[model samples]
Target chain A: MNLTDQQRTLIEQIGVWHENNGIQPAAARVMGLMIVSDKRELTFDEITEALSISKSATSNALNLLLRTEHLEYITFPGDRKRYFKMKISNWREAFTRKIDDLTGFNVLLRQVLEVRNRNCDESDEGLQDFISFLDYLHQELPNLLAKWEEQNKKS
Target chain B: MNLTDQQRTLIEQIGVWHENNGIQPAAARVMGLMIVSDKRELTFDEITEALSISKSATSNALNLLLRTEHLEYITFPGDRKRYFKMKISNWREAFTRKIDDLTGFNVLLRQVLEVRNRNCDESDEGLQDFISFLDYLHQELPNLLAKWEEQNKKS
Candidate 1:
């Protein structure tokens, strides 16, 4: 499908930002394309040809999305080509899992500090300061999440 | 700073996941390092030297973190070197802003859809469906944010 000049520029902007942020732009591109396309599900060839990226790049990118539970694969009863679609199925599940992952990582950090702190003398100001930082995160994250929810409700 | 074999492996695992997800591993590494390190703030050269990456990479990555408001830089009165530290100042701000950016982009997509949908009529079910998908995102994000907050509190 031919993209207008404006659409082309917008796509490039999104791609660059995604790349910089450490996300594969292809998935976002695919999402954009699927959302804008006349057809909801396009073949592998169509995706590669449209994005001008390699098939492997598209495949790897899509695979990551699927693994992260962001996208799902589809097959029409008679159609041979598999189709892909975004899963907004549970936005709560999608976003919360990521946040939970971050929190879990924080908990691991606290454990490390606990073990290490015990081995060190109380005079180790450096270690104490670092542990304090983790403690701050532990306390702050819950409130932050609450604020996001409140803002969400207001909006 | 020499890392144990186990530490190195763990770092690499986290790095790969961040890279795959489109986030720079350096930021993740830095966060990981902070969690494990005895020291709180690491100098620019120290992070670069520890990660075995170029100084520019460290600088750019740290600057990006600073811009995102996830990190802060401080200069001690006696020390000439600038030190970087993680800031848990506004976890909600960091995430809410990103969601806001996504919402803003949808506003543009909606404009494009208005034009595209009107022109396609019955022939373009895919395009219409795509627009609906975005419309769903627009509607559901705030609700998701609320749920995210509740989950955070329970944790």
Candidate 2:
């Protein structure tokens, strides 16, 4: 069996995973295609062909991935075409940023709560619970990660 | 100003927030309305009037909330109408369940990784990074929460 056939399920799985995380379907498919491809670097035409997606869709998906810094392109010294590959080194930063970004969301939740209280005889109880939970996460998630790092260093 | 006018922005904000989290817009608006209402318990007609949504939309949203256990109904001894209210008691469980749910996602990611390797000369680097990150979280997040509980008790 060919590489594509072998990885069809993987590609579909990753595509669904990305879609669940709120990525556009086409872009998610592109992400999955990149992940499972044996040929690490693929040009525009190659990506389009491998995914059975149109040029317009491939272009759009590529741009989205580029903007998100998940993928980057390289050019051969004499070649005009760009070959795209995953930006693997920044995985740690990207994952940590997801946690840090919650701080901003928590601030918004606080604001939401204040506004909710204005029209409420009894403020929303679930909102209060959610805010406190996020606050605890803000205070303690970093400490947890740091402790993990410390333990790993010692071990 | 009436309660609904006062909460217009809060409702919109929450509606958008839930939409971003992948909830349907109508259901999200209903969730928001429940959070900001001056009246803790609302009948079907009241929910419909406040949101200006169609009867069907209101009914569907209410049912969705009910199924998720985010909202529940209460009835007086002689009154027939059910009054829908937010389920305030299970906030901690709802929030912590989110973290526990990641275990299921991580398991799927492992399976996805295995399948991807079948077609690949080199495995996906980012997938490897993400698995490690989740593995770290799985190992240490509970410990971190436990430590926080202990510290609170001592203080």
Candidate 3:
């Protein structure tokens, strides 16, 4: 489907945000388009035209997105084209990983603490404090997720 | 102070991790060195030699890390040389921003929902559901942080 001016503008805005977050430009725009496009699913050609991107670029971006679980595909009974759709539901895993990564440093922080000289007591204590703080966050995330889900069900 | 083989290896590991997260290589290594070093602080020449990085590259990385608040500098009464130190304390704020950025999408999500064609029901509802999920997370973060702090005090 052809995009409206508003849709095109929104795509760029979303695209820029994703690109700044380290996603390559083509892949970022493709994801932005999938979210903003009116159609629930798009053929490979539709994605290419919507973003005005090259075929190889679109193919590469699609592969990256699919591999990353941001997008998924389906084939119809008689259709030769693959329909790509958003797998945003999987974002809970992605978002959870982002939060977990905060606490994930505990492992390395411990490693860091292990090798420090005993004379660097202050900073060593600082590292230990940070580790406990991260451990607290890690333990508490499940509680937060449960709370978010519980509230989500209510509303 | 010269970095030990163990320290150098740790620096490389930490530097690689930071670089994967989009930090420039020189800046990443410099930050890693500051964290793993035995000294609480390092001077300009020291950072350069320790990293075996060029003067210009070291200078740029120092400026980047200092500006980003990951490192800070000090001046001594008699010493002309500046001593740069770790500011890992500021990371809590950085981590807070990371959490906030997940929910930060609500503003843009609402905008995306606003302009979508009414017929695009499934994806629109999907976006709406995602927004509310994010809203729940946003509302609940402070409570999680408070809980973490509370638990930290008990232990």
Quick one: best TM-score, which candidate?
Answer: 3
True contacts kept of each: 0.10, 0.24, 0.38
TM-score of each: 0.58, 0.84, 0.94
Flag the better candidate by DockQ, 2 or 3: 3
**lDDT by residue (tens digit), candidate 1, B19-46:** 5545677876765554445455678888
Between candidates 1 and 2, the one scoring higher on TM-score is 2
Candidate 1 global Cα RMSD? 7.2
Docking class of 3: medium
Off by over 4 Å in 3: B118-120
Q: TM-score of model 2, chain A?
A: 0.79
* Residue lDDT tens for model 2, B89-155: 6555565666666666677677666655434534565566567667888776767666655765565
Better of 1 and 3 by TM-score: 3
lDDT of 1 by residue, A76-147 (tens): 798788787656454446445655656555555455454332334542443344344435544554565555
lDDT of 2 by residue, A1-155 (tens): 13556577777777887888788988887877776766667899988888888999999999999998878999999999999987766565665677666766676667666655445434554566567666777787777667656765674
Interface RMSD of 2: 3.6
Report residue A34 deviation for candidate 1 (angstroms).
0.4
Error (Å) of candidate 2 at residue B12 is: 0.2
